[model samples]
Target: MKHTYTDAMADIETLDTRPSAVVISIGVVLFNRREPKVKMKELNLKFGKKEFRDEQIMMGRTVDKETVAWWKGQEPDAKRIFKQANVTSMEDALNKLTAFLTQGDTNYLIWGNGSDFDNTIITSLYESFGMQAPWKFWNNRCFRTFKGEHGHITRPPEFQGVKHDAVDDARQQARYLQAIYAELQKYNILSYKERQQ
Candidate 1:
């Protein structure tokens, strides 16, 4: 069977780990589960520190003390986005993501690191803005779950950029997930042959 559906890996950097996390950055990469270049989109939100957290809290977003402490303990490189000069508001960022995800494709399988993390947070943000998420709910996927289930592949891609940077993380995730998909295809083909014997 020919594969035609588009797959994407979405990631976010945030101040909390809940559905209502105060999202600060987002990265998404659209690709086929094959070795090829991907279309990437990234956005860094302008953070006003206490003011920003208060504003998002007003809109029903959340923050966590441990997440804040974790960020403080990270290396300076991983925390660079907080110092970014060029940034967008959350509304504009979500709008751009919607445009990117829905513009060139129809059947999409959007992957997040975890089922309850990236996609959930993004969807919550859309709800905060009273807007619709671009991808269908059923089409959402969990890369963390897939990896945990079938992580038998021996080799994986090298890390590209700083750990906390959303864009770099998304690219790395999509590559590894693609490797897993290839391994599954190989296994399926072998299993079919065994069944025919």
Candidate 2:
């Protein structure tokens, strides 16, 4: 029987991860492949100035100048959330994300855009703050891999909301995955939820 999952589509905007990367924002959407509804959450955080300067302290997590320059090249709307005046501390953001992930008893398959991007970065950030990641390693999933496998499936049009905003990105990705699953069902390509009794 093919396994199905209760997915948490997650995205993060960050300054690059060379020596040290700082998270600018996070977005997550909780949904089950077998279900149609979704629940979304997001956070915008302030980077620590001291950590930004200390190379050793930021080992394996440095922000790249190129990434910063690329961000500047993005559209104004894409950069709008980062410019918001009120941003939460990393601790506060992590706390809220933790609460959101563990709110119910459901086991989430945390789907990041790539294997080493959102989830990995968030885990590293949590460890830097002396906190454990909310989800387990076994729960990590890669949206890019799924997309690659189903490249023929047409995705829904890009969402009109803020492009780089975490919450909007997560919601859009979750909806896209849901649509793909629905199409798969319609064509009888795979009975994702069926057991081979």
Candidate 3:
């Protein structure tokens, strides 16, 4: 028999930057790939005393001017999350995310939009705070590569939520991955042995 389940999947959202990046939020969905069940958690962080200012860097977080400008072109719902009231401090957010990531003892495949984007930014944030990231380096996975190889995977009809909202994005991506994996299995394109690796 072959393994039918993946350990877990995590989707993170961040403010892109040079040198270092600021993680705006993290949304993780813990699930068994064999089953259609999942548990979700999200953390929203306050990067600085105010948005897009030197205070973020003074607190050891990086911000980029171009990235700020780019955000202006995004959807309004996507932009609203950033200004939501009562966001937690970066330290508190990190701690909560760490707790969320360790809820299960099993090692999980942490899926990010790109292999180097979300996970890299989070790891950098951990280093800046002098804390160790909960997941190992090898546990990182890329959703983009999977999508590219599999072609456009669509979201389930039930998920009518805003994109760029960390939790919603994570859930949608997880569902798409599950769909893609199942489709591959149906066509016998992905063998059990290959999947186990």
Candidate 4:
């Protein structure tokens, strides 16, 4: 609704939609992305349930006395981060996210790893609900950040390894966005001052 075809409008259309983020992490860093500027909402998700019990199983390892303590020891710092997270079922989470996206004329879904796994989960959920996800930006855009060889770069570190905890991954993915924003600034794609208005 904010966009209109006016005399001053050019042929070029800048896809200025802000992206909604969903993260999944392990013992490593967090990942996330904010919603569109018009929405003024951010969803932060973290993961901390490291030790699986009798019914918990992952990566060919079963939850038992021998493995419980070892996994528990690896989870303290991550647990602290997610102690107050907004946890929900994957389906419920997708509903909340889609609701937020539909509030704006255009929106994007961003993840550090692109749409392979993260997008798959979300789109699959959307399909299950008999709704189509708005993911054109996700399919079209590719994120890239500069790596410093000699000088310092002011970007968050890259995410490494998989922990499969949704919240943790969101935080890590958020960093990649910061880098992308920085690159946009350097090339005059966008600026904080312009975005604020």
Judged by lDDT, which candidate is best?
1
lDDT for predicted candidate 1 compared with the true structure:
0.75
| lDDT by residue for model 4 (1-197), tens | 34311000000000111122122221112122222232123344332223211111222212234333444555555434324334444345446555644554443434324323344434443554456755553332223222232114355566653333443444444454545555555667564753542
Q: Which ten residues in a row have the lowest lDDT in candidate 3?
A: 46-55
* Candidate 1 lDDT over residue span 1-197, tens digit each: 22443677888889999999987778787777644444444433335345555667889998899999999998898787676523356566668888778866466688899989999999998999889999889888898987887776735688888887887888888888877767766667435532332
Q: lDDT of each model, Cα atoms only?
A: 0.75, 0.70, 0.66, 0.35
Comparing 1 and 4 on lDDT, the stronger one? 1
Name every residue pair that clashes in candidate 3: none
lDDT of 2 by residue, 1-197 (tens): 22333668888777785314777777777776655643444443433234432432444456688988998899988776555533345567778788878876767888888878888888887887788988989888888787677646876647857888777787787777777777777787865433221
Q: Could you say which candidate leads in TM-score?
A: 1
Candidate 2, superposed: residue stretches over 4 Å from native? 1-5, 37-60, 85-87, 191-197
TM-score of each: 0.84, 0.80, 0.80, 0.42
Q: Write the per-residue lDDT of candidate 3 for residues 18-136, one digit (tens) a residue.
A: 43776566667665554555444444443333553243466577666688788788899878756653445666767877877777556677887787777777778778878898988
On a 0 to 100 scale, what is the lDDT of residue 92 in model 2?
A: 72
lDDT of 4 at 24: 28
**Total clashing pairs for each candidate:** 0, 6, 0, 18
Which regions in candidate 3 have their CA more than 4 angstroms from the true location? 1-7, 17-19, 38-56, 85-87, 152-159, 191-194
Order the candidate numbers by lDDT, best to worst.
1, 2, 3, 4
lDDT value, candidate 2, whole model: 0.70
